[model samples]
Target: MTTSQNPTAQAPYKQLRRPTTDRMIAGVASGLGRYFDADPTLVRVIFAVVTVLTGGLAALTYPVIWFLMPEEPPTAPPWPTAATTAAPAAATTTPAPTMPVHGDRGPI
Candidate 1:
């Protein structure tokens, strides 16, 4: 049996920029989180440690990123209410025919 592929499967990843909110410092962690799909808290923790280790040079670096990085716009919901409220179309009820195998096709 052949499987149907989704038409929207090839959509590209959205470009990530700095988040506009939830920032304690300069939103640098949030920007990195968006780019890498990682937790912002973890990024912040690492940045904090690095800042300490580097004698607060990293503290100076965050503001530069804040100034340079663009802010991300808020994302919208995937579907509209009309689409969600409509009843789903009925699915085909016919059973698929089984394929006959020839000889030994080792552990297919």
Candidate 2:
């Protein structure tokens, strides 16, 4: 039976994205773990074994995936956004303090 016809059918998994935290290198293992519903430690152990057994070919391939794989966007922190962020008007009102040109001697 087709999935659409079945009322119990679940939606397909989302595209893989590297997580922002709980990662040793690029979060590839953790991302894979989340996708497959597996333990990340197991994945990391497997990767390490494969890399060693294959004379580090997997090591080189890891960076390739890191470069290609999209990282997950950072989640908003639970903080007072208004107090942390400066308003555009307030920024314009206060000019940044000028530094003395040519060291601390104020203008040589």
Candidate 3:
């Protein structure tokens, strides 16, 4: 199956960044979610727990990511074409088999 393109696909990976829209606090979790190909909510929950356990030291790291991570441009979906839509039907059709000649016999 074809995979969707992400910011990493288009640009070089460096440090992680916060996502602009998906973020709950500072978008740090959303940025990590994009990098790791995971759900944003999961990352947020983990970070929240870490912050609580660390007595807010984990929370302090967020601003550093917020400043270091590059902003990702919004991606546009690929436009559907008639050929793309019809590809599945074409792929399902069977090809005709050729009969083997006596002298040219090989594995069927």
TM-score of 2: 0.55
Task: Evaluate residue 2 in candidate 3 and report its C-alpha lDDT on the 0 to 100 scale.
Answer: 90
* Every candidate's lDDT: 0.70, 0.73, 0.70
Model 2 vs truth, CA RMSD: 16.1
- Which rank order by TM-score, best down to worst? 2, 1, 3
Any runs in candidate 3 off by more than 4 Å, and if so which?
Answer: 1-9, 12-17, 74-108
For candidate 3, give the lDDT of residue 3: 86
lDDT of 2 by residue, 1-108 (tens): 655454333336455767887688889988777667677899899999999999998898888888888887665222223446666785579777988776577555
Q: Write the per-residue lDDT of candidate 1 for residues 42-94, one digit (tens) a residue.
A: 99989899999999999998878888887755552232234566766565355
TM-score of 1: 0.53
How far in Å is the alpha carbon of 93 misplaced in model 1? Answer: 17
- lDDT string for model 3 (1-90, tens) is 998766535334443655556668677777787678677889888988999999999988888877887765556222224556676866
Candidate whose lDDT is highest:
2
TM-score of each prediction: 0.53, 0.55, 0.53
